[model samples]
Target: MLRAQDLMTENVIAVTKDTEVRELALILTENKISGVPVIDGTGKLIGVVTESDLIFQNKKVHIPTAVAILDAFFFLESPEKMEQEMKKMSGVTVGDIYAPEVISVQKDTPLDELATLMAEKNIHTLPVLDKEELVGVIGKSDIIRTIAEGR
Candidate 1:
């Protein structure tokens, strides 16, 4: 069986959470990648930033609907909330859009298991960690390549 380390991308491109959304989007486009792992000052995996996160910045609207009305009754919707979302959509940094709850796998993990995990979680990528330090990243494309090459 192939291992995560065998197919993971070692030359991983990462960014800091404080990076601007515009810059992050550029990085993703330049690198031809959909997402990037967000690191902290100490180079620790703090979150995962993706194109979807950045795209959401262009989708903020305060038009109240039925869902908004229902949420308002529970104090879940307010002008302040809309303002905050608008701010996030406009001037928010990658830190504001990153998904802090990241999923990862060990470098030596079995590829079969990793694939299963990916399917179950509906995730397209997984960071490969060695003792909590990022060593590589594995994506569905990598898995396909591995299968095609019989690696």
Candidate 2:
């Protein structure tokens, strides 16, 4: 059966938390990739930053609704949500917007399981690991390319 190791890209383009937003955008555009894995000084995967995260910078912040009743204001929505949005909108570096929770696959993971995980999670890029070591990377394009080549 086809596995992650069969189709994954061995040479991966990645970023660090200290990477600036402008540089991240340029990397994405120049490399023609939608996202990249964020690694630390030790080369350990810590997060995933995507185009969606960068796009979020332009998203309008939604103010929480408050209902004024009897001279008392009661917020109908959580104000924390608005605070989070504001923080995301003001992000200047990958560390400010990258998703810390990452989903990874093993080298031996079957294609069906890999596809299912990506589909279910709505993930465009995934890190492939072997015993907690990054081995390769697999993106949606890889799967589509495989189908096109009838692999």
Candidate 3:
């Protein structure tokens, strides 16, 4: 079975928290990639920034419904969700909108497990880690290409 180290792209393209949204968009477009890993000053993986994050900027905000009863208010939806959406829509840098909870794989992870992780998490890109260091990245395209080659 192929491992993450065998299939992951070693030449990863990453950005810092301070990366501008416009710059991130440009990087994604130029590389034809859907997402990139975000690293800190020491090159440790901190989070991920993806096309979905960028698309959030253009998404319409759904206001939370609320009911006022006797001077008290009840929200049917999560107001925090709306606030987060608004922040993303108005974000200027990756730090403002990037997903901090990163789902990553280790070099020895089997391809099947990797595939399952991606599918279950609904993630298109995953950073490959060696301890706390970012070593590579795996994208959906990489899996497709590997399958095409019968690897």
Best by lDDT: 3
- Residue-level lDDT of model 3, residues 53-79, one tens digit each, is 999899877889999999999999988
Please give each candidate's TM-score: 0.81, 0.95, 0.97
lDDT of each: 0.82, 0.93, 0.95
Q: Once all C-alphas are superposed, what RMSD does model 2 give against the true structure? A: 1.1
TM-score of 1: 0.81
Better of 2 and 3 by lDDT: 3
Give per-residue lDDT, candidate 2, residue 41.
92
**C-alpha positional error of residue 22 in candidate 2 after TM-score superposition, expressed in Å:** 0.5
Model 2: per-residue Cα lDDT over 1-151, one tens digit each: 8999999999989999999999999999999999999999999999999999999999877888899999999999988887878887899999999999999999999999989999999999899999888889999999999889998
Model 2 bad stretches (over 4 Å): none
After superposing candidate 1 on the true structure, give the runs of residues whose Cα lies further than 4 Å from its correct spot. Answer: 60-72, 75-88
How does residue 102 of candidate 1 score in lDDT?
Answer: 94
Q: Total clashing residue pairs per candidate?
A: 0, 0, 0
Best by TM-score: 3
